[model samples]
Target: MEFHEPVMVREVLSVLRPGPLSRVVDGTLGTAGHALEFARLIGSQGILVGLDRDPAMLAIGARRLNEAKGKDGPRLHLVARPYEEICEVLQDAGMTEGVDAILLDLGVNSLQLENPERGFAFSKEGPLDGRFNTEAQATTMADLVNNASERELADWLRDYADERLARPIARRIAARRALAPLRTTTELAELVREAYPPAQRFGRIHPATRTFQALRIAVNDEMGSVERGLKACMSALAPGGVLASISFHSIEDRITKRIFQGATDAKPDPSNPYSATTTEGLEFELPFRRPIACTAEEAESNPRARSAKLRAIRRMEVTS
Candidate 1:
């Protein structure tokens, strides 16, 4: 299976600037595309920790990294765990000093999206199973679609995907599932398509796109994971260390931006507005004022890069 081509590698490398002996973490190591370059930059004496929830991805990433690392390369540590558990992973690896750099390339990778059996693509025919870690997750897309109430379905569709036709779609799903459970991607897609008004049915994008995205997000609790993972990474950064995140959609981007902004921006105490004391300490600084977007050339070459946004922050050096 073809893993995702790491998006905006040049931009990520430029911001991260990992050096020889620097400890780094690729929190979303999808087949080691970015981790391979990091291993090269950090050199033989460096420590590289790669984390992924999917056991399949961890296995593939380990194999690829092993092939590239050879006899002289970074000490590799591949963990089958979510990025939210970064601190615990580091502690387990005996790196309480923290990591020099961390990277989180959020959202679904091409490995899961392109594979029909993964049930991430609305256009494909597959089982309604969208769990990233099938062995761990008890609930699946099938379970959500077949068991969730109309209100629950509508709420998830609206909140997760920003689907405007959430109510109509939920109504349709409720009506259909009353007769038989929705069991396939195509079945759910068609139901969502039918929910749209005839004129809006065949727009530039498929009617089911938002619905599918919402379902996948709900099935995997993707937003919650991203939020927790971002916080964990920021806390796990060593002094003068850098953290970079690549988000595929607006919601994910917003969560990253919020966490990074909170760390970098200081707020005044509400009780005493004139006081110099601030509620938050300036522990981190934004490397760039604005998030970086993929270049035109990159967007043209890789369609997935169109919506990709890269943001970076650096932990400030502490002085006595």
Candidate 2:
């Protein structure tokens, strides 16, 4: 897999300001980019715990960290697990009281997206399997497209996958599946592309991009997982500890912004869901009243970071 440049590296480091005696937990250590930076910031007196659900990624991250020099080198602790179980993982490590900071860069990793064999991209030709971990019991993208009824597929696309033309695409997929099951990325992409006119397919980007995104999100429960993971990560922060999250879509960003603003007692108005809530009733406090995005320079350098919305919160007090 090609090395993926970590998006918004400077912003992540700034939000997760580390120092000696601090311990940082990187809940989604894809290539250990953030973990390495966090470890270096915290120094030799501090520790860094890196976690990922994919053992393949964990292996690569371990090698990367091991080869690093100075502070980031051996102070790194690696774990192969999902970010949702962050609380449990920390407790098992005897660090449950929390750590100095926590960072979660949500969505698909570059490693996963670039590898066609991983089936995360329609641009690549591979099996329809989109499981973050091949060992996971969850059904792959293929199972949903091949076995689901037209109504089921449509609902998935409209609700979970957020495809605007979900109904029509689902109808086309169902019709195609009757002749042969959709087993590969190209097969499914072609079906979605076929549902559109040639002009639509030849647009700025493939029309199937959004449809593919919706399917991956559905298959992985990406949005739901972000909600649960954010809460868990906030709960795992030490007093005055920081938690930073980078969300790639509005659905994820809305949740992150609301949670951060509410936790900080900085909710905008009655329209804000947790405007009336108090810190005594919640987990943490937001350090920023609004979500922050990448700078023009960062966006220009990394187009993927353009859609990214970053929000941060700090633990005021540790709950019993």
Candidate 3:
């Protein structure tokens, strides 16, 4: 199967200027698109470690990398682990602080959604499975919809998706599940669609888009993973090394913003109510205060690129 094109390719390459001898990490190597580019840039002398939680993605990434120049290509290290486990994987590979740069294109891969079996697309008729790693024992969207209390469901919808009609949607889900369990994507999507009025469905996008995004985020722990993975990337990179991340949603973007902003200096206090000394420690400066996005032309070519926001930071010092 052809993989979805990686978003913000130019920005990623610009942030991670991997030389022929540099070692780079593609922490969220979904389709190996970025990994392949890194391998090509680094040539045979450099090492490109590709990590992903999905076994299928890891297999595909390995095959893609292996097929390209093989013995003459950069040393390919493909790991089936979440990006949060970067430090452990790097240690296992004896890389230590040997990395030159790291990239994390966060959120679900388009390939997963396009494949009916993966169950990521609400438009597709498939199981409600949303786990990045099939081995993960976490509760799926099916379990959430079928088992959670209406109140709990409402809270999740409102908090995660910022949905105004969360209460009604939760009630509808509870009522529907009582008739029968929600086992598939289409079933859940239908219930959510029913929650909206007919006029709302005529809008620019599907009404169930936010709800599906929220469910997937909750099931996969996307925000938590991004925060933890950012820290791991910072720890794994060599001094002066760069770290770049592409977040597609507001929640992920907020986390990236806070982390990148804090890394620049001592974290600001929101609890003290009143505080002085805004200027602080470690010089983790954001190369771009505002995230860089794809051009309109690129977005036209790749619709997925429209939502991608690339944020990069330069590591100045190791925390003592």
Task: Rank the candidate models, highest lDDT first.
Answer: 1, 3, 2
Residue 152 shift from truth in candidate 3, angstroms: 2.9
lDDT: which candidate is best?
Answer: 1
Candidate 1: pairs in clash: none
lDDT of 3 at 127: 95
Give the CA lDDT, 0 to 100, for residue 310 in model 2.
84
The 10-residue segment of model 2 with minimum total lDDT is: 274-283
What lDDT score is found at residue 21 in candidate 1? Answer: 93
Candidates 2 and 3, the one with greater TM-score: 3
Best by TM-score: 1
| TM-score for each candidate, following the candidate numbering | 0.93, 0.91, 0.91
What's the lDDT of the predicted structure labeled candidate 3? 0.82
lDDT of 1 by residue, 1-320 (tens): 47778899999999999889999999998788999999989999999999999888889889999999987789999999999999999999999998899999988888888888989888789999988899999999999999999999999999988899899899999999999999999999888888888998899899998888999999989998987888788889998999999998788988777777766656633443222221145388888968999999999999899999999888889989
lDDT of 1: 0.88
Q: What's the TM for model 3? A: 0.91
Rank candidates, TM-score, best first: 1, 3, 2
Model 3 ranges off by over 4 Å: 202-204, 266-268, 271-283, 317-320
